[model samples]
Every structure is written in C-alpha cells, then in structure tokens.
Target chain A: MRFINVIKVALRALRRSAMRSILTALGIIIGVAAVIAMVSIGNGAKSQVEASIASLGQNIISVYPGSATTGGMHGGWGSASSLTVDEALTIRREISGIVAVSPEMRDRQQVLANGLNWNSSVNGEDVTYLDIRLWTIAEGEMFTEGDVNSAAKVCVIGQTVVAKLFPDGDPVGRSLRIRNLPFKIVGVLKAKGFNYFGSDQDDVVIIPYTSHLKRIARRPNLNSIIIQAESPDQMTRIQQDVTDFLQQRRNGRDPDFTVRNQQELAEAATATTKTMTVLLGAIAGVSLIVGGIGIMNIMLVSVTERTREIGIRLAVGAHGRDVLTQFLVEAIILSVMGGTLGILLGVGSSQLISRLNGWPVLVSTSAIVGAVAFSAAIGVFFGFYPARKAAQLDPIEALRYE
Target chain B: MSHVVQLEDIHKTYESGEVPVLAVRGVTLTITGGEFVAIMGASGSGKSTLMNLLGCLDRPTRGRYLLGGTDVSNLDRNELADLRNQKLGFIFQGFNLLSRTTALENVELPMLYGRRHFSTREIRERARQSLDIVGLSNRADHFPSQLSGGQQQRVAIARALINEPQILLADEPTGNLDSKTSVEIMGVFQKLNAQGITIVMVTHELDIAHYCKRNLIMRDGRLVSDTPVVDRLVATEQMQRIVTAETDAKLIA
Candidate 1:
C-alpha cells in the first residue's frame, strides 16, 4: 500500500512537469538508440564477413609450400615450389576421412580469343577441384580424369574470362590461346563476386594439372593442395594427420610445407570487424553514462525544487524513506520509458540505414535485451545519491525552505 | 478531562554562529482534552518554537514532551513522523495546500501516508466526508488557486481532520485572511471544537486569541503569563454580528 502511494505521488509529480521529464528522457533515448543501431551495423558487417568466408567451402584445409632457406637468405611462403602432384596423390591414398583433394598449379598468362587478349590466372586442377571449393559449373561438363592423364588442352572458363574473351555468347567448346597454345573450353564456372581480400574470384580459368606440368609450364612442383574434410569436427584430426604424414614423407627432416584451416583464416579476417564493433559499442556506452548523469542532475534539482512539498509530506506523516522511494521510482520510470522508445528507434533506424545504404544489418536479440537491462541498472545507480540527499533533510528546515 | 498535552520545562536552543540563542527556556504547561488554546507572542518570543516542540516537528533541547501520553523527545525522525501522522494534525498560516491538486486529494494526503491501508473506495468516501464536515463537499474538485483564501484554509483544516488526529495544531490558521474571513475560519474551528476536538493555535491577534478558551503569552524565551479568557468569543456569534452590522451599514456590496 505504501509502495502504491509513493508511486502515485511520483506519477503526479512527473506529470506536473511533463516537458522537463520528456527532455530528461530524451538523453537516454539517444544513448540507447546509438547503442542498438551501432551494434546492429557491427553485427551485420561481422556476419557478412563470416558468410563470405563460409563460401570458401566448409571444413577445408589448405597446404602451402613453406619458406625456403639458403645459407643466409630466406624465401617466404609461396616463394618455394616445395610440393608435387605425386605427394598430393600419395596423401589422397593414405589419408582417411578425406572427402576430396585438388592439387593446384597456378600461372598468370595472356589469353587471346577472337582477336581480344587479356591477362588472367590460369590454374591447373583436378576433376574434383570444383566440388572441393564448393564452386558450381554453369555450362558444359567438367574435363574427365582421362583428359587429365592425357594432358588434354581442354579447360573450364570463369565468368570474368568469358566476359573478356567471349562477349558474344557462351564460350563452351570454344578454343582460347594460352601462350600461342590452343586449349578448348569444356565448361563455364558460375560467377562469385569477390573474397574478403578484395580480389575478383571469377577472373580465372582451370585446366588439368597434368596438362600444365607436362605441356604448358613444364614444372614438376604443385603450388598448393586443397583438401576437404568430411565434417567440421574432423578438421583438426585430419589436419594433424596431413601434417604428420607430410613430415614423415620428408624422412624425419624439417617439413617444407605450411598447413592452414578455414576457421583460422576466418578468425583472422573477422578480428578487425570485432575490434570495430567493440569500439563503436564503447562510444555508444559513454553516451549512456552521460545520460545517467543527466538523470542524476535532474533528480537532484527536482529534490531541491520540491523541498517545501517534501516538508508538507513529512509533516503529514510520510517517512523520509518514502520520499526516497518516490524519487527513485520517478528516475526508473524515466529511464525505462526511454529505453523502450530507444529500442523501437534503434530497430527502425537500422532498417532504414540498411535500405538506404544497402548495408547488411543484423539486429541481435542479445544486444537488445542487454542494452535495456543496462539502462535500468543506470537508473538505479544514478538515482541513489539524489534520493538519499532528499531523504536526509530536516522536516522543519524543509518546511521553512523557500 | 484527561490531559492531551504535557510539557515539562521544555527548552529549545539554537546555535546561531558563535552565539547560542535560547529560543524557549523553562516552559512548562498542560492542556486537557477538548480544549481550544492559543499561544501568543511577538517576533522572537519563542511561541513558534514551543509550537514546533508540541507538534513534534522539532524535539526540545533539554526537556521532555508527552503528547497524548507518549514520550516524544526520544523518538527518531521516522517515529516522530508516524506519531505526527497518527496523533496530531497541523495547519499553517500560509494554508500550505499543494497547488494544482484538488481539495479532495489534499484531504486524502494524510491517509495516503498513514500506516494502516485504506481501500480506494474507503479513502475516497472518508475524504469526501471530511470535506463535507468542513462545508466544502461541492468544492472537492476545486484546486487551491481556484478557491478563496478562506476556502483554501478550510480545505487545509479538512486535510488535517481526515486522519482523525487527537489534536489539531494550527500555526496562525487565520493569519493570512481579512477580519471577516478570519472570523469565518474561526467559526469552522469553533464548530469542530464544539464536537470535542482538541485544537492548539498560535496567533498574534487578540480577537483570534479571544476565540480560544485559554491563552498562553510568551516573551524573551519564557512564558510571561498563562490565563483563561474572561470573555471567550464564539466564532458563530461573532460572524453573525459582523453580517448584521454590514447589512445595517449597507456595506453588503
């Protein structure tokens, strides 16, 4: 009953100064709105990065040729041609839980078709390369293993290569020249826009590794090997097996290859976005603190302004504790109302920004719940001092206050 | 009649900077139930201090005060507030009614602070009844600014009486009103007093003091005289005489 009375008193007092109350609540509104909107944008960017990484294919591990040493000089990763097609085939036969493998050998070459020439990365890969990388064939059929064994001059062209070399129609079955050597286009790959590194993924062509090794570049070494594990849980075990097998293949000598999994690359990629999210969130949180301080300032002024009213209530037998509760309840009401409004504003604005800027915005449920709960805590924390100050005033002096 | 207030050598002193100012010194008094008494003095005569001590708004510096048989000197702030709520009703010279609030809500204020919970219906019913007793039943919804000075004072009185306090303490209840409104407020008091309500009023007006049965004059922090009024004025009769005199003089307008 006493609680209800104080609530009634608080409500009446708030309504008495409706404009001041609304202005005070506006501080919290902007603070919470900033928090929610900023977090949504941050989360949206994060998920977008994650989705692009996921498109790299699930549960994949890539092995690259490690750095090479000669006396005092050291050549970095990818500088050493330290792997071969024979070693890749040996791993495929020896490793268990392996789904698919693509031994890759890449070279940049100027390709000419119908009197137009363009420089593009020409990769030599196996028949299972598309499946391992989760790339789909858009037109025609993949070159068979028989074509790989024979070092056939047949290839699959990427969307960028098709756009550049064959703008008229489908280039499937058409022939394009690489280094004055003609290679027939067997299939066309679906377009993938770009990776996180800002490099075009669709500007490429693929041919059998045997063809590149035996005919085009005449190199015995493979650039890298891409392997797909059956599932995410087996990635670690499969990675360990591959490393140990490669090391053993080196006859107990130092291995000349570096292994990396998809998750590690994804984590490294998302770290920057995570930092940005926290930075934006912290800046938004500072505004919330300032909002809390605003509440405290207004409550203190309210206590001083209503001194005589406090005296009247005290004289009428209201306890000092009752005054404290009434003021605290008023602060909480202001902040909670602001918080609710902030949530609506935040969600609406995020949607508007997403539409206007064409940016990905994912509003996380946890962030919404956390922001409100934090604002409520801010109410309680900032309201205590002013309320206590009001409660400790002498009724006689309060009555005498102007 | 049983004693409603008992003060024993109550002294109240204040430290005004370096000098210790004694507001009230060695004042002892007793008032029985159903008595309408007035405390009168000039400025700095300590009558307000004595009233403060009596109303339990401030404790005596060096003595004890028993209000309705309870020792109030040793009570804490909350205890005194509860005691004031339950046992005493206070009226101020300024008619300290909350502005913008309806008279009914002002009357209901005391009940809202009371310990025992009253249902909404009961609180509204009792507040309306209190307003009716003060003859402002129809003005229950009127704000303080909307009402006349006398009406506002009456609303304060109604608020004071809502809790059924054993004693009503009025600090210059008629101080802000003109002679006619003063007597009219006096008439309201006389009616409530006639119904056996104990009232303690502090006033400087001799005629206002004359309305009470007993008068205690204070000077220089001490009680100079305590005497019963030889010719007590009845508020109802005084208001009637004023009305008749006005009609005879043609000053009704």
Candidate 2:
C-alpha cells in the first residue's frame, strides 16, 4: 500500500535467501565494474591524445616536401627539393596571416661541452623558430636574426643536451664544439617532453640558419619551414596563403610541398581515440547485459520458490500491483547495491593500475553516472517479466502449494 | 437474523484436459450473523471448493454468491481482494501464518494491505489486541516455527480476527493437530463464535463438527444432509486440562 512498505517486503524476501541474493549481486557487480574500468581507460587515452595534440600548438603549421606529380627528374630522386632560406623570408614578408616563420637546416653531429660529448642532431634556425614551435628560452638570449645574417657561432641548446653535457654547471655562455667547430651556447631551451612517436623534443640543439648552412650542413638550401598563424581560426587562410606564395616563389612550378595544420591532425587523433573508447565500452557492455540476464533468471526462480508466499499475500488483500512492486523493488535494490560497490572497485583498480604501471588513467564523472544508470535500467528491464508472473499467480493454487 | 453470507444455486466446474469435472452442483446456502456452522464431507466432496467461493478467492461457474448482501461473483480481482480484507477472514489446515514474521507482525499484515491509513504504533497496538483475543499476547514476538501446531493455528486465528471481518472461514483448521490440541482449538473457536462472530469451518471429523450448532454434510458435489447438533459439547470445559499441559510446555520453552 505504501512505498516504504513495498521496500520492506522486498528486503525481507531477499533476506530469506542470503546465498542466492549474493550470487545474483555478483553478476551485476562484475558488469558495472568492467564498464567503469574500461570507460576510464578509454577516457584516459583520449585525454592523453588531446594533451599530445595540444602540446604541438594548434596554431602551428608544418610544411613538408610533397612528392613530384609528373616525371620526377625523369626518374631523378622522385622527391621535391629542399626549400631555400630566401623563400622562408619571402613568406614572412608576403603572407597576410603569418605570425612567425623559421627556415630549418638539420644535421647529425656530436655536441661537446666540458669533457662529455653526446651524439645528437643540430637544428639550425633563427630566433623565430622558438615562437613557431611554441618554445621558450629558459636561460640566456636566443640567436637573433643578426646572428643568422652574420653567420655567428652562437647557439641555443635543448634541455636534454644541457642535462647530459653540463650536468653540474650553467650551460649558458659556455663554449661547445659541434662538428669540431667551436660555438658559444647563448641560451637553454625549455623542456617540451616527448611526442606521440616518442621523439624527445628537448634532445636537439638550435643555431642560426646561416651558421648551419655555412659551417655544419655545408648546403645552400633549406630543409623545411615551420609557421605559426595568428590563431587556430586563421589556419585555413594561412595555409592557402603559404601554398600560393610557395607556388609563385618556385616560378609557378606548383612548388612540391604540403601544408599540414594542427587542427586537422588533432581532429584525426580525436576521432581515432573516441572510436577506441566506444569499442572498449561496447565490449564491456556485453558482460553487463549477461549480468542483467542472470538477474532475470534468478528473479524468475525466486518467484517460483515463493509461489505460496505470493498466494498468501494475495489471499489476505494484496493486489497484483502490490506483488509486482515488491519484487521490482528487490531487483532494483540489489542492482543499486552492486553498482555502488562496483564503482568503488573500478575506481580503486584504475588508480592502482596507474600507480603501479605508470599508465595514464582518468576517471570522468560521466563514466560513473553512466554505469550506475545503465545497471539500474537493466534491473527494471530484465526483472519485469518475473514480477509480472508473480503478480498474475492464482491465489487458490498458490495457497495450496507446498 | 441478518445473513452474513448467501449462496444462490452456486455451481462450479473444473476443466481438466478437455473434460469438465463437477466440483459443486447447484448448492444453495445462507449463513446468518453470529451463527457457528460446519461443513462435513469426505475428501473431494466439494466442501473446500465451496469455502474458496465464500472467501472470494474463486468464482462459481454459475449462480450468484453474495457476501454481506453484496453480489461478488462478478467482481474484479482487486475488488474481490478488497472484499476479503473487509468482510472475510480465512484459516487454513496447515496453519498458514507466514513463517518468517513474528506473531504480531503476521497479524498486522492484512490490515497493512488495505488502503486505510494507520500509524505504526496504531497498527502494532491493534495487532497486539488481536493476539490477546486469541490468548497469545504473551507470545507476540515468537515465530510460527517456535510455536506448537495449536499455537500456530491460534496465530492464524489472530490474523483472521485482526481485520475485524464479519465472517471467519476456517478450512480444516485442526487437521494437523493431535486429539487434545484439536479440542483445545475447538474451544477457542466456540469462544469466538459466542462473541457474535459468524464462522464456517470445513472438517471431516464428526466430533469436531459436533462443536458447532449447525452441520451440513456433502456427498458427490451435493448437500446430502443438514441438521442441528442437539447435544453439542462445551469444548472450553474439556480444554482446561490441555491448556494446563500447554502452560507447562510454554514454561519449558
């Protein structure tokens, strides 16, 4: 007759068979736990990918040499030639949306500081490279445009080289030898960690492009160019401007180079990770459905076992709605209890995994709420038939049941 | 006298695998308020089926059955349940007290099912008073299994009385008890009947039937005899000896 009374009756019935109640709860527990854990793992991976894409700077654009479409050298190298330093300067002057531009020359060499030498690459660029790649000088001054023009021997080193070569001293204003040529360390770059490909961004060295082309690479051309736009909203216009400018600079030869914007790469990464999360969550949901079916089966058995009890209540005064309400409440209580316990278990296990294995794990609020609601809905959906059967039982036959 | 229950040409037929088995054939009966009656018949003679019809648990295949002057033959399931709660109390042979509940709570169950509103204290107090009427107030906290067969039947009787129903229908109430316990239970029934509560009991025991003022015997789904018990025994006077023994058992427990 009253809602609380229905809960009391359902609880009393569940208490009658302790072992069966616990066994039924076990299925829901595993189901909810799997959902929470798997969802957290998926969210964790997605968040990590987002962080990685963010680290690359959403306003930055990378231009790589595009392959030749027609008769590449008539079978020459089949690849586009390196962009020149003069082309990079022309882009900074002509492009309407360009915020910064840095032409780069890269070569492998052993860096010498004090008595320790590390085999790492030398990246030659102007002061604009730091802004284009979203980097900052942590120590002294970065090599200026004057250094690039005069071919000065000043350089800016990454945090990794500073750690290895100058373990106990300040690396700024110190002399380091690259390719057996002496150079002054003008500044230390800030740490930017690793990328998706596990490449350490802090392990390279930066120098003036003039110095790199004249002394290190001994080449007259540039390798690539990094560009930063005013904002992410301006990326498309900036890409068009760069493509048009490069084609014109190459004498309308359809300059063999490709422009990649950060927004597109981030979107691709997001799509990949979101798909992975759903795939994992769906697999875990199968176990939840099985758990719901298990609850339904046990509820059916309970109705059968307590047939006489149902009869007695019906004989006394209970309506079919009353009988059905009692059983449905019992099912919900069991699942809710299981859901709460499963959340605790899932969260604790995720934390444990992160701490023990150093794996990325983030528990989002949506995952918790989603799992709990799903479990409760499962109880109602699966428990309905058994409750209906109990409600519809014939009181006369039930009273006579042994 | 105002009749508490009436059956007019009632008929019941059971369909078992395409064959109709007649359970009751055109039985007409009336029970007045405060009358104590017994239906005596051999097994399968339709006495229990008639009891079910009176209790509103089942409907007759034909004819009208009236409880408290209201025709209930065509009532819906919920309305029939309401009629049972308000007008009838049932006691079964197996002492159908819910085994897990305490005697007090078991008595309060029927009252709880009805739409009437009562505070918890009021419900408990009413249940306690019903238990006292059955002389089981001291054992209110005891479970069904903790009591003897006769005591459990008394609890059932208490449950039946809790709703203050106009009629008590007991189907073979003492069928599981020994001779002494059966007579003691008969004493309780006589006392209740004397208090102006109408009762209809089904029993095969001739001696048990003698405790009631009126007796009807059925054979082959039809009433063969209706007569008055001219020399009904004073069951309470005979019950004193057994009550004394039961007192000793309660003390031991």
Candidate 3:
C-alpha cells in the first residue's frame, strides 16, 4: 500500500473517535506544559541572579584583608588595618592588564544635608569607581583625580541616600556634612535594585579615598581594593600577580589579603537557582512519562476495540507492516499535535504568570524544540507494542472475532 | 476454460489448545472461471474452514491450493496477502463495513491496499464507479449505520469488486438478511456472475444453495456430494414474484 493511503487511513480512524483522541492527547498536553513552565521559571530566576551579579561589576577582582598574627594569637580577616592606599596605587601603576583601581574604605555615620539627617554607609573610592562597577551617574559628575590628590571634601550620593538625605530634589551640587565636616555632593548615583543577598545596592555615599583618609576617618590603612581586568583571558593572571606581589610585600609576614575574581562570585550566586531548575525539570519529566504511558494504554485499547476492523483490512490484503505503520502514525500524530498546542499554552501561560505574579520567565527556543521532539519520541516508545500486536494477529482469527 | 481455483487434498487442523481438532480433511475441489458454485453444510461441517483456505486467509496444513494457476498453499504471510489482493474478493455474512466510514471509502478500500497505485482523483472516480455498479451511487456519502442491511451488503459487494479480483468468495452472504433482501443480494451476485466473474459461496440455507449453478454438500469435515443443479433458481424471477405477490396482497386488503 502507498504511504499516503496509510496516513489517510490512520487519520480516518482517529477522526472516528474524535472526542476520545483529544482526551487521550490531553495527558501529553499537560505533561509538555508542565515541563515548559517549570524550565522557563527556573531560567527566569537564574537570569535575574545573573543580572544582579552583573550589577556588582564587570571583570572585577576584589582583594580583602586577611588574618593578622600577633605572636601565637590571630585576628580574623577585617580585624586589623592591614592594607594601605599607597599599595593600591602602586599595583595599578605596575600591572599591565589592570584597567582601573578603587581603594575602598567603608564607615557608617550620620550625614546632615538640607536640614535633614540620615545614617548611611560612607565609601571612599577613585574617580574610575563608577566605570568599574558599571554604574551611571544620575546627575552631575564624579570627583576627579585632582579632588583625590588635594583631599577635596567632595562626595557622590547613591539613590537611597538621595531619597533619604535630600527628599525634595537632586542632591548634586549640594552640601552634606559627614562627622561635622561639610562635604560638597558632586554627583548622584543611579538606582540599582536589590542584590542576590536581598540588600539594596543604592544606599551609599562615596568620597575620594584621600579625603576619607586625611579629613574624616583619620586612618592610613584601607578596607579593600577593587581592580578591573582589561580582558577576561588575563583576569586570572592579573589576580595571581596582585596576590603574589601583595604577599611578597609582606616579606614572610602573615598574609593579610585574599583575592577573588568575578567568575567565582557568579558561580556561587547562580548555584541555588541551577539546582531549582533541575528539580523542577525532573518533576515535569515524570509527568511526561505518565503521559506516554497514557498514550500506550489508549493505543492498546484502540487495537483491542478494532480487532475486527483489522481483520477486515488483513483479509482485503493489507500487509502486517501496513497495519503497524497506520497505528504507529496515529500515535505520533496525536503526540506531535498535542506537543504543538502545549508549546503555545506553555509560552502564553508562563508569560501571563510572569506578568501577573511579577516574576521573571524566559521561554527558550531550544526548550520548545526539545519538548516537541521528546513528545514524539514518547509516542514512538509507547506506540510500538500495541501496533505490533495488531499486526501479528492471525487474519482468520481476527475475522472470526466478534 | 481456465481453472480459477484448484485445491488438491487440502487439510487444515486447529491445534489451538491442548487438543487438536481437524477442521478440513483432504478436500479436493476445482472451480473454473465464470462459474457460480455454492458449498452447503451444517455447522461444524468445515465449510467455513474450506472457505478461509480458498480465500488465502489461512494456510492449509498439507497439500497444494492453486489460485489463478499459482500455488498458494506454502506461500508466506505477506505473499498470501498480496495474492488475496491481486486475485480474490471476499464478502462476509456480517456485512463487516468499517463503522463511521462513508460507503464510498468502503468501496475504495480494496484499491487502497492493492499493488497498483491510484491517484487521489482516480481512486475517488473508481470508488464512485464501483458504487455506481452496485446501484448505491446516491448513498455513497452515507455511513454504514445510516445504510440498511441490504445497502450495506451492496456496499461490501462494491468494495469486493473494486480490485477486479479473479474470484469472489462469499461466506453466507445472505445469512443475516430477510428473504426479500436475500433475493436482492442474490440478484447482485447473479448479475456479476453473468458478466463473467467467478463466484464461490458457502451457505447452510438450501434455497440459497439452489441459486447457484452447481452445489457441493459437506459433512463431518468432508465433502459428501457435488452436482450441477438441474433446476437452478433465478433471483430476478424470485424478486419479481415477491413484488407481484406483495402488490396482489395489498389489492386484496
């Protein structure tokens, strides 16, 4: 028999029980939808984490002060003043792959501005700090190198600090008094949403490290130093060089710094969401298997119900392979059609959930293609036995069957 | 005249369960082209088994059965199916039309499975022609459930003829029909037979047996008698007489 004719026969048989065919296909529909929805939700969360991590900085390496030893006694990482601002400048001038350097020193204090006072974190940094952190200035401009060299009492305020200290309007070109020292607010930092740790990124006041060291904090040691790598390929080499040079500068003393790169931070941040995605995908896979079994069960029932019909075809000269092909094609058509509809429903529903629940959802083309292909494979896997049974039946016995 | 079917000492045994039951015992038969013959017997007399063997639905245990001058007894499953498609047509007593299918599609079924290819338009045209030959062209679009028993049987006949088989096999074709409908079915067979198509029918009814030109009677898994009918029954005359009697009875009422 011609292949086209076989398809027509299979189609006619399916249409014979249209309601049953659709109901049988519903199992597959739900299975595919669950897979798509769960995977997209997981991807959405992962993307959100990645975006937050990107907000931290691009190609950044951070150096934190390590433990200090005092003759059989030890102080943990941030316990002693271990790093100096002069060393940060020395490293930036020496490293070839280094693009920018920001020596960080954080201290929280009450700041008064425009007849209002708010306690906020004060950070001392370089002019290149905004570029390395991928942050944009919302108003005015950052403090220049001349400001850092002269110890000018100029500062940049973050969005949260602006909202708190200057509620009426822009904080740029204004005055804020830090620890009784009135500093000019030169710029307003753009707002960045919450980080993966659930802490706000836009609640800081930034000043030149020279100003914080000479006028406010009255200290010479620094808290941390942030470095930007010129290219991804050279980040590790630069990080190694900075760590060795800093340790060498100690000259056999207890190491007082730990260096970490951006990739490590991103990996740590995304670990939880990746686990969540795998768990959701596994649960959805179980439903898809159940759907396949449902298809097998319905196909078996159909074969049993159509024994006499099969017998008639056999008697009229249909080959056993023809019968097998017809029934197998029927199952594949059911699953493929169900999978197509499921993709539409899954994409639409995921977008709707994202919109209504205010959650991120990313529907990928590969996921859509994989779901359809998986459903078709399920069809073939589940459809083989019943089709074989129908094909191998004795024609005489089948004809005699009521 | 060329022999359309030649069976030599054919044997069929049913080893289905623990015990073996002999269904056909060394039956020899020959049917020439254009001949109308009927085999009559009681239930369990192996007439159905013989019909199945002749139709290539089952392989005989021993001996050769030649259909259209080709030996088909030892042929494999697919080969036998091909032979059935190329050389034989079958009509069952149950009028086993696929449910929910239109009569036109039922008629097109044989051509769908045949070795020769037919275009969609050609298949449709041929199905229409087959239905037209069976005088069911107007009812082509109607499903089997909507058709009467006689109409459904006619549809089956149309299906059988579509492949233009060398032999037509009928196993109690009129067993499920009332007398008038039976006569109508017989009329169709006789008309086809007159057009030089070979026909073999198995029926328990003696009256239906007489409609054939020759008769063979089986008993105890063996053929007991084979003879030409001296006074054959004509379906057209019987149909006419029935109509005249119905009209006369209505006049009396």
lDDT of each: 0.87, 0.84, 0.87
Query: Stretches of candidate 2 above 4 Å error?
Result: A14-22, A49-61, A64-81, A89-100, A110-119, A126-128, A131-136, A141-153, A177-183, A192-200, A227-283, A364-366, A400-402, B237-253
DockQ of 2: 0.59
Off by over 4 Å in 3: A58-77, A90-100, A115-117, A164-171, A179-182, A194-200, A227-269, B237-253
> What is the Cα-based lDDT of residue B230 in candidate 2?
97
* lDDT of model 3, residue B187: 92
DockQ of 3: 0.70
In TM-score terms, which candidate is top? 3
Could you list the iRMS of every candidate? Answer: 1.3, 1.3, 0.9
Clashing pairs in 2: none
Over A1-402, each residue of candidate 2 has an lDDT whose tens digit, in order, gives: 888778767887778667667867777787788888888888888888888787776578777776654543432222456577777888889887778888878778998979999988798887788776667889998888888889999998888998999999598988899989999999998899987679888998889988999999897777678888887788889899888877776786655777777788888899999999999889778877787778667766666556777888899989989888887887788878888888888888878766776668988687778777777776766566655765686678777765
What docking tier does model 1 reach? Answer: medium
How high is each candidate's TM-score? 0.82, 0.85, 0.88
Candidate 3 lDDT tens digits, A284-392: 7887778767766775666655777888899899999998888788888887889888888888888987788777889977777776777767666656665576668
TM-score of chain A of each: 0.80, 0.80, 0.88
Could you tell me which 10 consecutive residues in candidate 1 chain A have the lowest summed lDDT?
A: A382-391
Q: Per-residue lDDT tens digits of candidate 1, residues A372-396?
A: 7777666656555655655677778
| lDDT of candidate 2 over B91-173, digit per residue (tens) | 99987777667888889889878778677788899999999998999999998889999999999999999889999999999
lDDT of 1 by residue, B60-108 (tens): 8999888888788899999999988889999999888887688998999
lDDT at A207 for candidate 3? 96
